[model samples]
Target: MGTTRTIKNKHAANGSGIKGSKASKNGPVNDGVIKAKKNAGTRAPIPGSGVKGRPNLADILKKRKKRVYSEKELGLPQLNMVTPVGVQKPRGKKKGKVFVDDRESMATILAIVQAEKDGQIESKMIKARQMEEIREARRAEADKKESERKAKLEETKDSLRKKRKRPRAGGKTQDDDVNGFEAVKALAAEGTKAAKPKKKRVSFAAD
Candidate 1:
């Protein structure tokens, strides 16, 4: 039979399992922050310290900035460029006058322009003559109608005059007419002359 002897010993050091070596005062921290650390510093190294060839670990997080550009900074020209308040830029360049070097082409253009002007003038004269002829024809027709109206009026007047001068049926107007005082006296004198002297002549012849 064999008896085995085992002796156990207790350690006095901290048993923390964190990694990496302690760094400078303002160095980056990886194992979360110590709320109570304040401005205080720690000197104890982590249990599983240095990684052979690397420096102390750092966990850095930086914010990304948005890009900005001015009109001058833009690569292409900007049509919507805003002018600064109370400031005016220079005006655009003026256009130069164009000179024609070919005199033959210019002369041809002038001849075409003259032909167009002459055609327009002749057409206007012909239109004016046609309008005048139309007005003259209307006036002559109006004058003819007026002459016919006057002739009709004259015929009506002549017919009325003839109607007034024409004789009617009866012819014995003097005998059946009523006598005035002068006609009665003339008739009585003729009757007295015819009745008195003839009786005395008849008596002498009988004796």
Candidate 2:
């Protein structure tokens, strides 16, 4: 009979089995240094700290300083202009009177103006004559109506005279008719008698 020796594993001999290096005692590594968390517990306040009681607005405005910021400080981009400055625009053409050298056209225009004037004068004269004729006709009509009225009045007067001169029926008797006739005869006889001759008075005065 032979005796055998047993070999023990090396990994089992170590304390841990992880593959990487041992972890650090502190937290994970950061690219920059970490700041410690501030204490939230109450502490004595600073004299210049916390929300300050608002100061007088007028005093603050009066004492405030004005700061002018440059374009570089404000981070504005630079601008480039391409066009030229101060170029004057073209001037417009001015208006001027033009004279014509055509004498025949000018004479024709003058003749046309004179013809218009003559037409206006003729129209005015014709209107005046027509108005005069209308007035004369009205006057003639008035005169004719007046003459007719006078003739009618004269006819009425003649009619009234005839009515007055006409004898009334049953108003005259036969005796009245006879008396009127005898009176007319006596007047005719007196008018027909001749005047007597003057008597001679010379014989009685001689004795």
For each candidate, the alpha-carbon lDDT, in order, equals: 0.40, 0.39
Candidate 2 residue lDDT tens string, 44-109? 122112333323421221122111122123543234345455453334744555555699888988
Best by TM-score: 1
Clashes, model 2: 0
- Report clashes for each candidate as comma-separated counts: 0, 0
| Model 1 lDDT per residue over 1-207, tens place | 011100000000000102121323332243223211211223212221343222232111100000111322445433448778656544574556656679998998899999999999999999999999999999999999999999999998787545322211231233124334433343444356756433432332222
Clashing pairs in 1: none
lDDT measured at residue 140 in model 1 versus the true structure, 0 to 100: 97
TM-score of 2: 0.33
Task: Return the TM-score for each candidate structure.
Answer: 0.35, 0.33
Q: Write down the RMSD of candidate 1 (Cα, Å).
A: 28.3
Q: Give lDDT for model 1.
A: 0.40
